[model samples]
Target: MIRIKRAYEEVKESDGFRILIDRLWPRGVSKEKLKIDLWLKEIAPSSELRKSFGHDPNRWEEFQSKYRDELKEKSELLIQIKKLEEKLGNISLIYSAKDEKHDNAVVLLELLNN
Candidate 1:
């Protein structure tokens, strides 16, 4: 199974193969503190799309749609994520977004699970 978690949260033993799915590093979080298994920047949404949404709740639907399209085109990255998922008991996708409801990791988790 896949899980979405905030970058600031402490890594638990149950969070197997923790991966950071953000294009940019989360603010104020040092690499050492994150306890990440991988940083999949290539799997993140393009900067253009990220800036366009700007975390607007009104754009959430469109953001998710567009982001899925991006993911569709990134089959290699998806395959990599899938490979990790197959190897690990649990896959934790970490993101830096302040709003848990609107982050890219949520969309990624949905897409990955589907």
Candidate 2:
């Protein structure tokens, strides 16, 4: 199974094989505190796209659409996520965004489950 989590959330044993999917590290979060197994920055949205969206709810739809298009070029990274899920049973895609419902991780969770 695939799950999405905020980088600042408390770590849990059930959050298996945690992967930090943000292109940039969460501000003020230390490596030890994050407890991530992998930092898959390449799986994150491009800097241009992220800047364009700016986490505005009004822009979420457009962001998701454009992000999905960008994801098409990241087939290998997507496959890598799948492999981790299969091997780990429960993998979490971690992000630093404050808007939980409108983040790239949300889009990725939907895509992976489908």
Candidate 3:
């Protein structure tokens, strides 16, 4: 199973393989605090796409579309995530966005599940 978690959330054993999917680290979060197993920055949306979306909920639909398009070129990274999930049983995708519902992690979860 794949799960999405906020970078600010407390780490738990049940989180399994924790992967940070953001291009940049979260503000005020330290490496020790986050405790991520992998930082898959390559799977993150491009800087241009990220800045254009700007975490604006109004742009969420468009963001998902554009991000999905970006993901097509990252099949190797996606396969890595799938392999981890197979080995780990549970894989947690971590992100640093304030808006949980509209963040890149949410879109990634959707893509991974489908």
Structural similarity to truth (TM-score) of each candidate? 0.95, 0.98, 0.97
Quality of model 1 by C-alpha lDDT: 0.90
lDDT of each: 0.90, 0.94, 0.93
Q: List the RMSD of every prediction in angstroms.
A: 0.9, 0.6, 0.6
Compared with the true structure, model 2 gives a TM-score of 0.98
Compose the digit string of candidate 3's lDDT tens values, residues 1-114. Answer: 999999999999999999999999999999999998999999999999999999999999999999999999998898899988888799999999999899889988988898
Best by lDDT: 2
- Give the winner by lDDT: 1 or 3: 3
Query: Candidate 2 — worst ten consecutive residues by lDDT sum?
Result: 79-88
Candidate 1 per-residue C-alpha lDDT over 1-114 given as tens digits, one digit per residue, 9 for 90 to 100: 789999999889898988899999989988889998899999999999999999999999999999999988898988888888888769899999989999798898887888
User: Can you tell me which runs of candidate 1 are displaced by over 4 Å?
Assistant: none
Residue 9 of model 2, lDDT score: 96
